[model samples]
Target chain A: MSEVPNLDIIIKGCSKNDRESQKQLYKLYYSYAMSICLRYSRNYDDAVEVLNDAFMKVFSNIDKYDTARPFKAWLRVILINASIDHYKKNLKHNKNQELSETQGMTSDFRPDNEIRYEDLMRLVQKLSPVYRAVFNLYVIDGYKHKEIAEMLNINVSTSKANLTKAKANLRKMLKVYEDAAI
Target chain B: MQPYKDDIDQLFQEGLSSGNIPFDESAWIKMEKRLDAADTIAFAYWKLIYPLAVILVIVLAIWLWPGTSDNAESAPPVVTENIETHNNTDANPSSANNESSTTPEIGAKEKESYKQAPEEEDNAETDTTTLTESLGPSKISAENTDEPDVVRATVSENEATENSPSFTGGGEEYQSRFGGDLKILEGLDWMALDGYRGGEVEMTEVPMDTTREEVIKKSKLLFGLTVSNDWSAVGVSEFTNSGPSIGAIVEYLVLKRISVLAGASIGSRKYSAVGEEYWRPRWMDRSPGNEINTIAANCRVVDIPVNIYYHFAPKGLNQFSIGSGISSYLMLREDYAYTYNFADPNLPDTWVWENRNKHYFGVYNLSVVYRRQLSDKLYLGVEPYFKIPLTEIGIGEVDLYSFGTTVSLKFKK
Candidate 1:
């Protein structure tokens, strides 16, 4: 039952719809959960929306939590699912550039490894909702493309295409940022 | 420090991994309101679940309780009575049942019955008196007297545990003097309906054995539909690919503690490869150039799985089992889309290999399955499994090892 520190009482309270305890629980993992939401969100406002939605789920389903597992893993899954839900509303624009067209674009695209974390997050935020979602799911969250496709209600090739384009766009943005840095 | 320019997955994985978001009090306030609203709605709706659950529990209890089979059972057999029975006139034994009177053997049996009648008369009278007491005056007259109204008291008219006993014991004849109306098994201990009079006895007990066997056999065989997601990792490739599989599964319990399971499903084995590790089939016109490319190989396959499971707990509401199996993957259709570096495309730009075979041998699999019996004939199950590939498959011809979980709803025969 290794939970986040001081979570036993707060989780119980949250399950009981205790306001103060819910607040404490939310604040406890606010930044941690928001970091994930941000990578998948378009901006700060969107990130907050996803974070709040994920928290709502956590509080609503608090009683179902198994204390034997790590709490973060459970919370992470909920956050990812919530992010996917938010992304689905934006999935109508599900178009991607042809894979062949993605060629010749990476020439001399030496990555600026010294790029700051905040800048990288901004660069990720610049991707379209579907691309950012696919990138976040496949790269950071380590979901397979098949899982991403199911979550996003799309095909496997679409997930792969989105991930490839996401990385390409990120590199292109990194290049512009690197030239600006010089 | 230099890095592989194309492989940026790790870069973002590391960059975005720093956890924690600044606490937003406004967001919490907004969520609190939503939670309060949700709580009210949930309370209003969830109250009905209690009553529903209670009703379901009552139904389940009655359904599963032992010996309370059906009203058709538990209900007493109907016997028609009140026909005036004729007086015992002709003691023609051959006209009564399946015996011939002219035969010396039957004559000897009748003489034996006449002898035993005097000795067993006291017990016979007492048992008959009980049947006579259940209704109007008895129709049977062992002393050959008046025609009594037919008594509706029927013995062995309902199903009993099947018992086949000797027709005669101690040389005492079971044949009644009047013959068929009161044919009795003199040595059968299952029932001693010593004084059933003027009632036609039907052999209803024999059918119960087949009925019981049918129920047992039906429960032993289970049929189910299954859906699963498996991730296959080709040899020496860091990438793990996933595909959805839908199938039908059949399980037959061969023993109390073991069962055999088999399934046939169509599944996709697709992956995103981003390195030089490429296995080309004979279909491609060109070979690999000196550049990293992306090959999104999409494959549809038929997987046949055969396995044996040993149950840890078989007869219960919940069952746990460990199983090991072999799966054969047959590639049906495969299409690979290759996007290579733009620079090096002059020298053939493609590669090919021969020895293309559609049939892939079995991949060994092991799984732990948990099933909860939802009803007498239905079960819900989840099985987590791992498959180690002994055969190379797909257009890439890679040893595609996979691990996944399958969810199933099974119905027992």
Candidate 2:
């Protein structure tokens, strides 16, 4: 892991377009940005792309950054927007439809059982782009369905439906993992 | 399902959030390359825009300076006293005839004094009077019968002389037989007239009646077409979304100096963004490297503006005006497309997103307009305008403010 520098100095350097400060800033936030991007993206490669793009934006608009705000939060917002932009660009080919009827899942699963992080990531990646985006935005990011609807340019009901379907798909994937572990 | 669903969600959320994913070292190299490329393109765009803006400013300054001079030359002085007298005489012709018959005797006395003056010996005034008297009683009767023409001609002739004193004393002259005032004496120094003509001096009559009627008749409606470059005022240097705007408008002159304008315009705004999309090939067990896409969001807007203008000189050929209005924007189409690097070589890459249900926004504008009359019915105008958003354009919190210069061609009816 790269040692994080003082944010104020890094921001100032980035604002001046200094490559070393930008590289340092990118390294410090790399893991956090990757984690968020991965949840919103289809695969590890897509997550890396989102991370790079987000970092570029951070470096480019560093002058607008306020020192009072958390840099991580600001970086996360850019990543989310980048992810959505990616989705929008590829929306024409996206064949995933909103499942109208909610699917019921088995209730016998244990919550305390440990699951590998890689396994969880795989399950999350299996969900459709719309479902994954809605799921991550609502469940992990704590955004309301209305806010998600506005951000993604979709109806609130569609946002709710996608979240429900994402959870259902995850439950089924988790069942297989649980069975294999046993 | 509900009881276990919460636990499953918590497990996934905690698991995903806790992981310390390693950054790919190779991705930074690609990202740095893209950042460098973007910087070059941005610099090139600025290099083009800066000179264009400076040239436009200089051109506008040159055009506006001469416009004031043209307007000053076109606005004729208003003949207030003559217009009132003419209207009264037209209403009562019998009274006009009585005044005309008696005024000529006084005019004859004035003519004698005018001729006796040593300076008046070489004057053209004596010849004009001789020509009128030799035309006989028929012409005299005709002049007495129609008084307005005689008065108008006398006024026009007096106005032609630059150095002549006001018609208070030496200025009065009898109506010539030619139905016009006598010409000035020849010995008068023409140099005095030329010297006093400099600056904003009133040189001609306004012809109030004709001007009022012409303004009421010809200036009721106007149509115009405009083209401009628009950019955000608040982060002006940082904003790269400045775009071109085109519009057509119709104005109704509610009063001579004030008009109400309504028009529709189509314009676009663009911004650069970076994005990534995932692709997995059937041959590979793991996902391939993320494909970097440089995207530009192009937003097309349809705007309708309603404004009221106050003209500095509505009757003049060249006029300066200030106006304030409200413009409503309806988002017609918005698309995010990859501007660089097509991923698929074989399949025709149609990568774009069309957004719907876009909310309408409003902007308030203040503008200064300079119009130069090209002909009796056509005018060319340059308006520099400032616009402020009354409402947010989209979900974004940034308030969009813009300053632009518009060049227009207007037709008045």
Candidate 3:
């Protein structure tokens, strides 16, 4: 971390519209941003698109960034907004589908379960767009039900209902994974 | 229905937050291209707007300025025309009447005496001499006794009025008829007026050489002291301050109606940064738990300005001048300090000062000066000026626009 260049100096350079500084900043946050984008996007290509859009916005509005606040938190907000914008643009075809309620076996998996991060990401991506957005906004981003509703442009009950359905679907997938492991 | 909600949420939060998922390096290249495109668009808009804004300001300043060609041509012509008309109607008629009455008396008496007896005309000449002496000194000679009566009378009438001490009312008429010729009269000594019924005063011919000399003599050097309050704001920053400035200027006439002025001033302004404060790691300072909070700066500047002023009514007591100039500001001192809090109670309240660069900046100024002459050599004036900086003042941080009203006292020599 000490060997890495100072973020404030890099941000100042980016504020001056320096292309190299922008690239440096993008490379620094690329992996962290990609993880968030992947959860919101349908595929790797869509995630790349979201990442590009969010980074462009960050570079453009670099002047507004206050050095005192955590830079990553500000960047996270921009990426989330980019994701929401991407969702809204493709909303006509990417509408959430109706899912029937499923009853599944409750398995007590220890903390040392063998689920890789890649498997978790795959399962999260398998969820419908609306459920995935709500789940990401509420669960991963720590937004309240009301905030998630506002962000997704849905009511609180719909957000709560979507979170429940998302959790049930994940449980059904986990049950399948557990059965396979046994 | 969803007892495993907490588990699913924890599972995904931990999994996603911790994931260092690899992304294609080509995305940065694409993003850089997009950023470049956006920057180009922004630069294009700025390139268009900047020149347009400058043109608009210059056009507006020229249009609104008082001494512009339109106002100069329109105002002075109307005023001069009225003065000319008044002088022509009032002074010309009265002077003509005075000449008509007095000239006939002197001419008829000489004519009658000459016709009665050529020898006796000498006695009549003595009488005429006495009459002329009573009236004033006459330029008419005895040889003019043979000339035409009207011509002789007109000559005597003009001479009488020119020397008459009582003819103060004809001053403006004399001035109008013989432009700058009265400058000669200003050098002469004359006696007080006694009532003398005489002919109307005639206009005199003025020498062109003396007129130029008098105009040159009237062009005086002016020195002025000004005090003003400038309301200034940093470029695109939500911080502004009103500061006092004091200056002295010297003006010299470069043309008949244009003068060049140069001056120096000193002023100070305070600025504060706008935003929320958060603690970030400080690598430079070894002090424990140092957290940056508020940032503020006070800038002291010295300025030198060169301006060209156009006086609308140079001879009038109420003078309106419009000028434009450039000023160079030397940043004498910039105290840029930021407050930082320490998590340790043992560390007292602390502030760190940052070194500011760029000691000089330039600004363009447009001003309107309205002056009322308090005396022949003293004038009191109010100048409202607008200033736009050519470069940012504080490092790369801010540009400033200043509007000020300066009250000045000027002395002319």
Candidate 4:
């Protein structure tokens, strides 16, 4: 009873679409949701867009939230789905560009030997959107290549290829940073 | 594979797992605005009932109007066959089962029981959420249990990220971390572990003035094709004056049970009446009368009907709707055949073309529609409609009443 004492009330309030409960839910999960979105999105703006969109879905469909499942786990899934939706919606304008052509990824950006969260985020975001999505889905989110392929509407082989490409790019970016630090 | 492949994966998973940005107040404000625009999902009955009220008013007015009473008599007879029956079944099987099994005792039993195959549990990814749970991850709602470090994800593919199917929800470590949902704000006080964190590294802040596409679609559109036999039943003190009409319709639902439809159909209102008192359009020359002269009209018209409808959509494949609105008919082709009453009906001199298709706004149209779902996007429907002319039409300028039942194929978009 000591654990999550008010969570049931909050969930019930959220299910009824109480605005204060919705705000409480959004505030409660903002960090957790934002963390997930940032890993999949390209930048701060895109991640924020994805975050709010996911929250909107959460509020609209709270009644569908099965009481048996862990709420964090459910929220994680929604955030990931919202990120994919954002990616697909902007796929035309944000098609996979080469690392050099990536607009805001600056080579001059430097970090210490022990790369902090910001530096590490830039290293991952430096990968193209497709590669980043594949990496996030497969490596971080524990989705299989087959599952990722189905979610992304790509061939299984294509999913494997994108994961490979994402790893190689991340390795290259980390190497450049390491060489500069040395 | 590169030596750092696994290292790369572990590095990102570990790094991105725990940290969060300061909650931006603007996000909640914007979300509140969106919620305001599209209210919480209670179907507004007023939208559906408004159409019915309007139709009732019009029906009463037509019933009382002495001048138009003669035309109202030609309305197509009502077919009172039951449109909605056997509604005990539901549209979705799972929902039907849920509704049937949701007695309070069964509901309590349901919380303790799951239909999950036991073999599936052996394949559960126990580590999927254990990593995050150890990190004091947020967003939890659960009952207290002695087990502090339970790994709860089940093996269902659709629920790959979901917790144990039997879990009441939340996690012990997760709850202790935030202390409750509201403790996340106070948790932010301890959130300054790294000053350079939370996407603050030279990130470009988008202007608050930047707008998104706010014109989200509030309604769904349906396209239709209609083919029917149209009747001009003013009787002319005679009977059986009907013609063929073919046209297309576009309808969109503005609310749950209310829709506005507008259509343009090319229909002909043809009949033979006594030539003695036949009224002529100004553009036509009065026919040179002969012995035993009578009139036959073969007029092609384009009818535009706009209607507001209220529908009773049951949880089955069939939907029934009632609508009342106005119709405007354009004179497409008018050829008055002047016969000596004994002359050949096809005699060349007996036919005269008076005017081109003239746009004439004429009648009040009412329709009773029945539609069946053929497939997800397509619907098979029959709509029987009647038009009481507000103004007279054609060479006779008679109280030309039109009635028809159209078979239509509707596709929803």
**What lDDT score belongs to each candidate, Candidate 1 first?**
0.58, 0.56, 0.57, 0.57
* Segments in model 2 whose C-alpha atoms lie over 4 Å from true places: A1-5, A96-113, B1-6, B44-54, B57-304, B308-326, B330-413
Task: Specify the highest-TM-score model's number.
Answer: 2
Question: Model 2: per-residue lDDT, tens digit, A17-107?
Answer: 8888888788888888888888887788888877787787778777755555456655766777788877776677665544322122123
The segments of candidate 1 whose C-alpha lies over 4 angstroms from its true place after superposition are A1-5, A61-70, A88-119, A143-158, A175-182, B1-7, B14-20, B43-82, B85-413
List residue ranges in candidate 3 displaced over 4 A.
Answer: A1-24, A61-71, A91-113, A149-158, A168-182, B1-6, B35-51, B61-413
User: In terms of TM-score, how similar is model 2 to the real structure?
Assistant: 0.53
lDDT of 4 at B330: 81
Ten residues in sequence with the least summed lDDT for candidate 4 chain B:
B186-195
Separate DockQ for every predicted complex: 0.22, 0.20, 0.21, 0.14
Interface RMSD of the predictions, in order shown?
14.0, 12.7, 10.2, 26.0
Candidate 2, residue B120: lDDT: 42
Minimum summed lDDT over a 10-residue window in model 1 chain A is located at: A97-106
State how far residue B11 of model 1 sits from its true place (Å): 4.9
lDDT of 2 by residue, B227-297 (tens): 77776533334356678877788988676468888998777765544433212112111114434354445
Native-referenced DockQ of model 3: 0.21
Error of 4 at B63 (Å): 12
User: Could you list the CA RMSD of all candidates, in the order they appear?
Assistant: 17.0, 15.8, 18.5, 41.1
Q: How high is the lDDT of residue B351 in model 2?
A: 26
